[model samples]
Target: MDPFKNWQDWRKNLDAFFGENFLSSFENILLYNYFPQVNVYKTDNELIVLANIPGLNDINNVDVFIDYQSLELRGNVNLKYKGFKLIQDELFNGHFERKINLPYPVKEDRIDATYQNGLLIIHLHRLIPDDHRRHKIEIKKIEE
Candidate 1:
């Protein structure tokens, strides 16, 4: 091993490999990740999901959906800036979407949503079964 392989040389090589705007691009990717952070909770009769979504200007623009097996959230973060040059922006912008798998089937008609303080809360009611499947039949003797 050569003693000339110093920390500064390694850092320079890393910087060159990743390009001059590497850090900013990496930060942007992290900030605008595909999925928003969410928390899920379940009770005996319902399931609730809370998602963190800052920079949302209007609640009506967000869409929420739920089916028997999954839940989906989609929205856009509209940020309007004047003639000021953006030096470093780490906040997420544009359309954001997230889908979550539910542990049990849910009634789609009973779903509700509310947004407050940069968080969106969704409520889903569990589906109830109304049918019983086992029926007793008389056994017939097999003829040889």
Candidate 2:
């Protein structure tokens, strides 16, 4: 009594028993996201995330904050074109806030952010391990 299994096996049996367009129709539905698209990248010593926020935010209004293990991106997307009606309105407008869970805790004090060409680029430096903080080792010579 497993409710869900492999789609390939389930589809063949379900379609023959039911109908063909049932599954195909489900795939055609459009997906919507409130926040703009974002991409995250990692290096050995740092984490970089780029958010595509074109025509939505300015550098002064954008805010970047981190607490413990998560980074919160809260900002206002200005709807400058609010009064004008659009012939073809595809872009989303209004307020947008996206919070992302960071893989590693960064140096909260040394965070940097830059916005250029309608893209918000956030840079955070990784924190070094406590054990590696002190590299003092004791050397002993063997007494024969």
Q: Which candidate leads the pack in lDDT?
A: 1
User: Which parts of model 2 have CA positions greater than 4 angstroms off?
Assistant: 1-31, 132-144
TM-score of model 1 (CA atoms): 0.67
Residue 89, model 2, lDDT: 45
lDDT of 2 by residue, 1-144 (tens): 112325568767777888875566543222124365677789988899888887754576667778855777777776656678768645656666777777788888878888888888888888776885767799999999
Clashing pairs in 1: none
CA RMSD per model (angstroms): 10.5, 9.6
Model 2 scores a C-alpha lDDT of 0.70
Q: Candidate 1, residues 1-144: lDDT per residue as tens digits?
A: 222226356546767998765555454454456446777899988998999888788987788877677988888887768987778766777888877888788997898888889999888899987778777999999999
Q: Candidates' TM-scores?
A: 0.67, 0.64
Question: What is residue 5's positional error in candidate 1, in angstroms?
Answer: 38
Number of the predicted model whose TM-score against the real structure is largest: 1
**lDDT value for model 1:** 0.77
